[model samples]
Target: MLYNLYNEKKDNRKEKFWFRAIFYLFLLIFIGTVCWIFFFSSLLKINSVEVIFQETQTEYDLFNKDYLISLVKTAFQTESSGFYLDHISRANFFLFNVDHFSQLIEKKSLWISKVEIYKKFPQSIQIIIIPRDGAFILQGEEDFLVDGQGMVFAKKNDFLKESATLPILSFEMKRSVKINDQVLESKSAKFLTIISSIFSEQSGFELKPEFFTPSLISNELEAQVVIDNGWKIFFNTERDPVIQSKLVRKVLDEVIKEKISDLEYIDLRLPGKVIYKLKGQPINADDSDAQESKSESKEKKDDRN
Candidate 1:
């Protein structure tokens, strides 16, 4: 009777273990099904869409309403195959889609700030944009606006009929006009250094050049620096621009003291020599021949008299 009781007790324990296992299995399935119905299914089925932009410009409106919505819908369909409840993954996917959409739009001036996804019901997404702060023109032909990094983010339409009052960058025609990436990578560092040194010496004076064109005469790339005051300074690219600038300042101080403005060209290419041509004086080799001819004529007149 005792043996029979032991076997019965072992059997009861086995039954209890199986019962608990089945109960927990069913509970897990029920929870999973509830989650599938409430969150994933409902979230995946977008019902409404919202688009936001920092600025309400016509161009921004066109992109947010027309172009970006369609792109997001397509992206959502592709992403829904492997959707998750993790907030991090959702945020990352949204950012990725924003960047992709921005590239597809190809509007250089438009900057994307935030792309948000909301679960309304059937199928939709929300997108937001933040455009760059400053807008500048490029080469007087192309309209490119730059971000804080000096990157050319967007290019406006030529027919927009807008006048941009930014300083024109007059370097060689490069593949990109952005000053942030390409400039630092290329010859811009040296140029920037020169500009900085000039600024340090000339306190309280703004020396922004309207255009920078390459000079023909000197080994250094001479820039025809046009200031807002209608005075043009011929700056050399090779020499330390700081030293050259000091020399220029000295010459200008003297010239201003003498009250001279009828100057043709000021050559800052050479060291210790600030050669300037008067308004009517010839600056080339031909001037010597003219001077000799005039002297000869004057001698003949004296002999004849």
Candidate 2:
């Protein structure tokens, strides 16, 4: 009877062990089903995308909508590492990488300057595109439209109306530029623009805008504005362009005063003075008989005296 009781206890332990094993197996299957429903299922996949563009100054045709849509769609379908395998669909809303997509768009599209992305819950995406606009025209071996940030975006032939109206800046030699390249420094471009507007308004003649930025040397870092009357004016780029402009206006009104034909060059690079050279005399000539009207900076005056 004691032996029979021991056997009964052993059999009871075996039954409990089987029951625990079955319960654990069912729990694992239930957890796996939940993971499949949330991750590998079709309910959370992205099915649609909407693209909105910021209004740009250039023609709408410059930014192609179909190309942009294709790029976004391609980004959405990119493959990701799976939980069980190497390939999985990135179309799922939770798996989509927004930062990577934005960078991809900006990198590939030259017309696009900025991009914003939004994910609509349950199955859609929205993106906004901001395009680059022409700020000035740089004429060289080829002409290009440059934005305020100094990036070249399009060719001149592409925008005829804009090319006609905007200020034209040229180098002495041809500039090798392609789309999406920075052709000018922002500071230099702004200085040239200010000088152009001021000269056009005051002198009543458009400048042959050739900016010489060859070196750090003072002589090479000058703005040469050739007037219609066959004379020139030189401005120091390192100096304040506003003050130089004021001095130019003052000399035009008070000193030169319609004597532009006799003028060789008005050198405003000098501070507190306006130096004018005439056609007959050489530049930096001693003002003895007054063929060249002289305005000298303190250093120059000290040299002459």
Task: Give all candidates' CA lDDT scores.
Answer: 0.47, 0.64
Compose the digit string of candidate 2's lDDT tens values, residues 1-305: 99999999999999999999999999999898877766787777777788876656543243345655566566545532243354345677787788887888788766668889899987888888776665667777788877777778877775334324565665554556898887666666556556766766765655664555443123323455554565666676545565566566666676667766787777765544466787786654222212122332443567789
Summarize candidate 1's per-residue lDDT along 1-305 as a digit string, tens digits: 99999999999999999999999999999999866655555444444446555553333222223444455456545544444546323323232354555454434324443444343333555655444443333453455544434455455442223443344444454444442332221233344324533644752234553445442112343334334333445555544555556555665675533534555556655444566665666552112223333554576689799
Q: Name the candidate that leads on TM-score.
A: 2
List the lowest-lDDT window of 10 residues for candidate 1: 284-293
Candidate 1 segments exceeding 4 Å error? 3-11, 30-137, 140-165, 170-185, 188-209, 214-229, 254-256, 281-305
* Decoy 2 TM-score against native: 0.55
Give the clashing residue pairs of candidate 2, or none. Answer: none
Q: Which candidate is the best by lDDT?
A: 2
Root-mean-square deviation of every model: 14.3, 8.3
